[model samples]
Target: MGDIIRVRGLEKRYGEVRALDGLDLTVPEGTVLGLLGPNGAGKTTAVRVITTLLRPDAGTAEVAGIDVLADPMEVRRRIGLSGQYAAVDEHLTGRENLEMVGRLYGFPRARARARAGELLERFDLADAGDRPSKTYSGGMRRRLDLAGALVAAPPVLVLDEPTTGLDPRSRIQMWEVIRELVSGGTSLLLTTQYLEEADRLADEIVVIDAGRAIARGTADQLKRQTGGERVQLVLADVADRDRTRVLLGEVCRSDVRDGETERELAAPAEGAATLMEVLRRLEEEGIAVLDIGLRRPTLDDVFLTLTGHGAEAPGTARTEEPAR
Candidate 1:
């Protein structure tokens, strides 16, 4: 596939804060590229630069063969963007919101209405099309927001945290919709905090940290780069935690204890073989293991290993809340 979006040496700064610093990215035609990062990692900044909402301090970006800096209007015409929040007008009906966006895109009134109806039906929003957006659920409003973006039928879509705060079922539904779009040949740049979402939807994954691209690869490739497999051991008794740790220390090079019931170990061998050996050792030691298994390293593991922080780590501003 040809490259539909290309960015190089992008940089952005706000006063003393450097939002983006020498970032680069590429998206092949008809594939989804997942952009993963923490809250302040410049994912949103990248999206803004690509969508022409904000100009970069340095570097260049191209969308659909048009240079974003040289011809931002042309890039805008060929791209759609859905940001973190649904941008629907609360007073407008769902259909009205989409039709309004279509008109803003320069579709004729008739064409806009037709397009709106088509998208409403396609997105399963037809039944709610006549209701005001304020009456819609979070999922419905999000679907409608996405429908608005597609009204222009752009070749490239930039979705920023499209599934944030959605219920599990709604997130799954949105994922299916994204798959359908990609299947029909739309190039997508999706910025998300959800590792599982990236693992499921992204053809390639880019991990960003502190305004820089730290890693990029397919999900499996990233996992492999993290090295080895994960072994989860759940002890039969909380009292055995210390003894279990000592026993695991023989074969496990790294371990994390979660409360009293669970401990995670990282082994340098393939998970299954290492798990079997560990189980044997436990049995010989009369450890009475309750559960044990081998599993592939998750995207979370990669994030933690790379940043010395978990993906779910709260932003600095929000870290002062008392734990419930």
Candidate 2:
């Protein structure tokens, strides 16, 4: 499949504040590309530019062979977008909101009505189809908005934090919905702050910071790039902390990490072999273990490594550029 969304040298600025500075991205057909960043790293700005909702101050974006700047209408026709907030109409019934989207996209009245029903069913909003969207839960309303985006059955989909503010159950439901859509061969560009979400749904991930692309690769590749493995042990008795630490360091041939918690001791574990060796030695030394496991580097590690901040850290809004 070809690149359905292509962006190069994209730039957007609000006076002295740069929302996007020489940003570049690409999403191939039938794949989900996760866009991750700190609160103001231009992920939302990039989505707007690709969806033709915001004009870029520089560079080019092409969606499904249509240049977003020169022919945004054509690009819009080939793509669907669900933004950070649910854009459903409060006064409108869930069905009506989707039907309106279909009508706006030029579907015939009968087809629009039918498409609305199909989307409501597909998104698991069928039971609430006749109710005013204002009466729906946050997840229901988000599903309605996503259904509205799909009313025209566009080949490419762009979602910006679609699961934000959703409860765990709702987030999982949304993930199932997204998987179903992608299974049908729709290419997707997803911008999300949830590291686990990206880990589950993305075929590739792009991490941006300070308005520039900082890292791009598959989840595992990025994890490997971040560094190696670590083993965490919960000691039944914290008295042996020093012994455990020294044993782990000797086994893994490196220093151990500390201070997160008193009972939990963490150390670098090069691989399963090192972990096994540590376990054997700890047993010999009469160390009590509550729990132990070797874990590879996670996306959170990658984010902190590349951006110098964790994604869940409190973020100051980028006030210079209002989110469009």
Candidate 3:
């Protein structure tokens, strides 16, 4: 399928900071493109540029064949955007919020009402449709905001960190909603710092750092670049850390690295054979581990290898321009 969203050499600067530097990305029709990056990595900047919320210093962006810079109004009409925060009015009921969006898009009153009702049902918000959004939970508000974006039923959907602050269950619910949209042929561009989110949702992944596209591929392709399985260890005692590292270094293909906790460590392994060897060696030394497993290289490994740092939290990077 042809690309429904295309960006070439897109650049945006904030004084001395370059939010987007010669970045290029595309989303195939009816496919999901996950713009994976740490906070302040220009993911949001690129989204703003593509969605026509902000002008780029230099570059070309198109949505549904319309030039973003040349005819932004036309471009806007063909795409829907759900930004980082739920952009719903607390005073309005969920149904009213969606209907307002429909009216803004120039739908007549009858059609707007009908569309709002349809979306409330689609997003599983019909039960809370008439409640003031301030009374809804965080997830409910988010679903309502996304429903508002779909009021026009645009062909392309842009979600900027859609599940950033959601609880696990809420995030999964949002994923289901997104999956259903894609199944019905909606093209998606999803920006997120969550590795699992990208691995689970994206058809293609783009890894960006400091406003540049560093890597682009499917999740498996990117994982392959890191190579081999990772043998993860959770030591029974923190005192065994050094000894565990020494043991891991002997059998692992690469140096053992500290995990999230002091008791945890990970190293690259050849495969199941390597895992078995490590197990035997550890057992022989009488070293104990709370957990041990061999798993394929994850997107986190790919990010660490490519960027030399883990994904930053949302809002840690100063990538946006001040209000104009």
On TM-score, the leading prediction is 3
Clashing pairs in 1: none
- Candidate 3 CA-lDDT value: 0.86
TM-score of each model, paired residue for residue: 0.84, 0.84, 0.85
Candidate 2 residue-wise lDDT, 1-324, digit = tens: 689889999999999989999998999888999997768878899998998889999999999888999998999898888967438899999999998999999999999999999988988889999999999998988888888888888999999998888999999999999988898989999998766788789999998876888899987777666655778788888899988888887887766776346878676677788778888998999998988998765645666566655555523332222111
Candidate 2 similarity to native, TM-score: 0.84
Candidate 2, residue 246: the lDDT equals 86
lDDT of 2 at 75: 90
lDDT of 1 at 308: 51
Off by over 4 Å in 2: 233-242, 250-255, 258-265, 268-299, 312-324
lDDT of 1 by residue, 1-324 (tens): 679999998999999888888998999998999998878789999999999988999999999889998999899899998867438899999999999999999999999999999999999999999999999998888889889889999999999999989999999999998889888988999998877789889999999876778899997788777664667677767677777777666666555434222443334445577678778888887887666777565555676666655556622333222111
* Model 3 lDDT per residue over 84-201, tens place: 7438999999999999999999999999999999999989999999999999998888898899889999999999999999999999999988888888989999999877789889
lDDT of all predictions: 0.82, 0.84, 0.86
Clashes of 2: 0
Ranked candidates (lDDT, high to low): 3, 2, 1
